[model samples]
Target: MDLDAYVVAHAHEWARLEELVRAGRRTGPESDELVDRYQQVATHLSVIRTAAPDGEVVAYLSSLLNRARMAMLGARVLSWRAAGRFFTHQFPAALYRLRYWWLGCMAANIVVSAVLMWWFVDHPEVEQTLLSKQEVDDLVNNDFESYYSEHAASAFATRVWINNAWVAALCMALGITGVGVVWLLFQNVLNVAVVGSIMTRHDRADLFWGLILPHGLLELTAVFVAGGVGLKLFWSWIEPGGISRGNSLAIAGRTMVTVALGLVAVLFVSGIIEAFVTPSPLPTWARIAIGILAEIAFFAYVFVLGRQAVRAGHTGDISADLLEDRVATQD
Candidate 1:
């Protein structure tokens, strides 16, 4: 394994490969030659690593291989068409597939929040322990309502969007730990329940709903979706079924990315509602109606468009060429 000798021997093939990569366009014969040389140089690189392990030769070969690989794969070009398809097909399909997970999460949180709210309303002592008399009075009378309109609509919307997006991202990013998602969801539901309970006790329940229902419906749904996806990612390893745990996790992780991106748009819409519609002079009924409509529209997108995309074999995964090839396993 004379490194110098080997380099001299395969240097021509490496140069040919580099040339083809840099040429931008090649004839059929040149393309065939490029592939042939790439294979030879890759083999030579492996031998060099095994025998001599010369850093200079290794670095050169690595760079050459990278260029050759790119030439073979072709450059990826982002376009409006691809972006449109992603939102319409990939994101929605991912949401629809995970509908049950998020829906269950939503239902559970609602029940917990409602129970807490009821408990707080029935037991004034508990509420008093959580917040003092003056704090409760301020929240019920002015603080809760004024919080929405305190800032300008645009700034408020941006702030809300960033905050909510960060929460959703955390759910997916920390989902693998299993506990992170649950902890986040619990914290959020607790906050909501505490607030709802205080408002209800003070006879300001209408004001609470009037302000929150408009944006909270969609905002909470998006959060639940993230939590569900995170939990699902955690479950992929726990119950990988027949597939290898690595493969299951890889698939789930990819799908989780899709959900995270989709939630951004969902949260953005909710932010808009919270900033503009919630604090606007519109009637409470109208504001709540708008929120309900947005929620319905989201569900429709998932059930209708998402279902269609999934049925057509879209799994919210990147194209096959982008993914590593996995060995087929029998059930």
Candidate 2:
């Protein structure tokens, strides 16, 4: 069929589409197919305008193009509004699930902790090399037991809590970018490696409880969760299924605010303990128990309590039981 003639014939629909597009309510899936049809027709009209000389085809194509542009703009605006609402409503629930998400983080910490503990137990002299002189001196001579007893009396607790909270929030926020997450993980890995090397040299396997586990458990777990989120996004970029990479990022962005909130809470608590209790005279046995218990608590909440709460609160069919599953399928 002649392109000019076709566009001229569809002038009525084109005019209506223009009005619908301007209305903006005719967006989303309902209008998407219409938009696609309009585009295909417009493309044909453009070709006809270009090829056919001295014909009404140029005017016809112009009219179709204008209408299609309006419709597309309206659809985009409506889609964005809908996305905004979905995120606003879902963010709190996602944040609430961080306790469960921390299960992965806690497990990572345990693995790293065990490796460091084993290495430190086998080698004790590396402690001086791994840690700064100040750290070595404090660990070896500053009398942690005395420090602990006095820590509660000082403003240290409040100071530490605030500091740790910032760190946790920063880590989670950075997780939005793949490069940021890589930098974060590298810094943490190096720091832990150095500390692990030193602790092994000191023949102090229990140092983890005093210097590490108290707040470290929570602090480190938050790091892992942040890393996991970043890593997930990175992998999505690498293998974006059938969708465009930008689309995958949009989905990830949708879920990040909640993840960030959870990280902030975890860090706040870690900071409080690190500033006051960890350095003070708390019994090594007690610290170990607390650390171990906290790890256990996280897993229990994630696998048990989290599921129950989500099920009770969410009556709509969720399609899947796990977060990863839902995300994957949706993407």
Candidate 3:
């Protein structure tokens, strides 16, 4: 009850606790001892609160307790272990869990592009209606191919990365609207159809495929992934599956974050292929081969490692430690 006397009596114990905390890592006995010391210090603080409530002692013990809590919990943010697990487990698991959504988006886009391409090819004069003769000639003979080579390789690659990353980000961002994602995809496929039809009609089909395939495969897949993930965000609220709509939407939004981050890297790789491989002096087959390999690697990453991570109980959502507390809500 005498504050000064109490301090003198427990000063050695307090010093010992501080020593164990600053020791960095501990042996088995030391860990047990640390826990014991922590409990005693907490009790000491409690007694002070009730009996003396000394300001300086309370503050010191509070700060010590905060550090001790983090150390015991092993909380990490900017660590190699966290970053590595994010990519290998969390990212892939998210991709695998929602594989069908993106796969369907990819398939639907391909079919729409093919159908529109065929229609445009069948009606070659339709392009002539939109563009003047000179414009068509310039696009077929110069514009499409020259676009890739006009900028320096590194500059082009960076520009392409930023542009493609933006598109993927937009897809996910607009997913909440539901219709926004569909409209974006439609516009994307429509552009592809128009261009493919123009090239095929002008007897430049080979040129189109050579320039596009080297980057388009993986590039387009990333777009579909973003679009699909975005749609998942929308669907969560519409059908929350026994949970409150707010809770479901929050979970989906968090899960989509993993896709958003992973897609940035994916888009960067495709941009490099587009800027360098697409326009390089390498044989068309080799360039296309590189693109194919990248696309396969992405899918394999999703279906293989992602699948395993999901089965191992790794959700694409942020780790529990990183999540904020939520309030209950009605469905």
Candidate 4:
């Protein structure tokens, strides 16, 4: 194959292809001509690569082919439609699929918290070891309730949002380690249980529930969801099913990312309730009812909207075009 002679023959056609691509606007005739020239140059480049393997001309044709391909395909532009699809379809589907994991986490944490609270109520010495007498008194009589109203509502909400978001983010980020999620949940549950125990011992259990339930319900649920997604990621490698371990991890990782993003919105709502509603002058029943409504709404969002999206074949992974091409394999 005379590579130089081949180039000479097709050089003018390649130049014309470049000219059409660079012209920005194209008539129907020019667009048709561009497609034809692109195909011709692609074939020319293929032959050159097969015959000569490495050369400046092959590189030039390769670059030209890439630009023409992009021109034909058009650039991917971010739009409101893509954003809507993500939240309506992708995000909810991910949450619904991992619902069991997070729900289990929630149930287990509740039981553990209750058990610890019971133990603390039964044994006064355990509370002493955790906090000194003055500290315990302050927490029960003064600090526990006042903590909520100390800061302005807006600043407190922002603080709660950042803190809870960080914890949830850590759960997903450290979920690959398996034990990290468990440890985080354990630490959180223990703190809540201890506080409740102290309040109960002081005969302020009503106060405890009144202050915590308004925000704790949704706030803790968001944390459980994050932990659940993290644990799912960990298990993907342990039991990859029919897929390759790497592929399983990739799928779980993408889903975890989706859950992480979704949780930000979830935690924000909880933060608002915690800062504004929990410490507000509203009746305790009203505050708790609002929290319950928020919790119910979130679960409904998952089981209702999420189920439909999942049924429609969304799996929370990135769109197919965004995924890398992989060779097909048969198990």
- Could you say which candidate leads in TM-score? 1
Q: Per-residue alpha-carbon lDDT of model 4 for 1-331, expressed as tens digits? A: 7777877888899999999889777777986787777777777776776666567887798788778766654522244677688789999999998889999988999999999889989998988798999999899889999999999999999999999999999998889999999999999999999999899878899999999999999999999999999999999999998999999999999889888888888999999999999999999999999999999999899999999999999988877644422323222
Candidate 1 Cα RMSD (Å) = 5.7
The lDDT values for all models are 0.86, 0.56, 0.88, 0.87
Give the per-residue lDDT digits (tens) of candidate 1, residues 194-233. 8988888778889999999999999999999999999999
Candidate 4 local accuracy as lDDT? Answer: 0.87
Listed per model in order, the count of residue pairs whose N, CA or C atoms clash below 3 Å is: 0, 10, 0, 0
* Tens digit of per-residue lDDT, candidate 2, span 1-331: 3545865677676666555555645535647666655655555554554555345655654665666665564454467773453333333344344434434544665567567656765666656566668877575454443444455534766666566555555555676566776676666665666555554455554663467777777667767776666555565567788999987665555455455655565666666666665765668777666766766665564456545645556311121211211111110
Ranking by TM-score: 1, 4, 3, 2
RMSD of each: 5.7, 10.5, 7.7, 6.4
Model 4 superposed RMSD (Cα): 6.4
Please state the error at residue 45 of candidate 4 in Å. Answer: 14
> Compared to the true structure, candidate 3 yields what TM-score?
0.77
**lDDT, candidate 4, at 33:** 85
Worst lDDT 10-window in candidate 2: 322-331
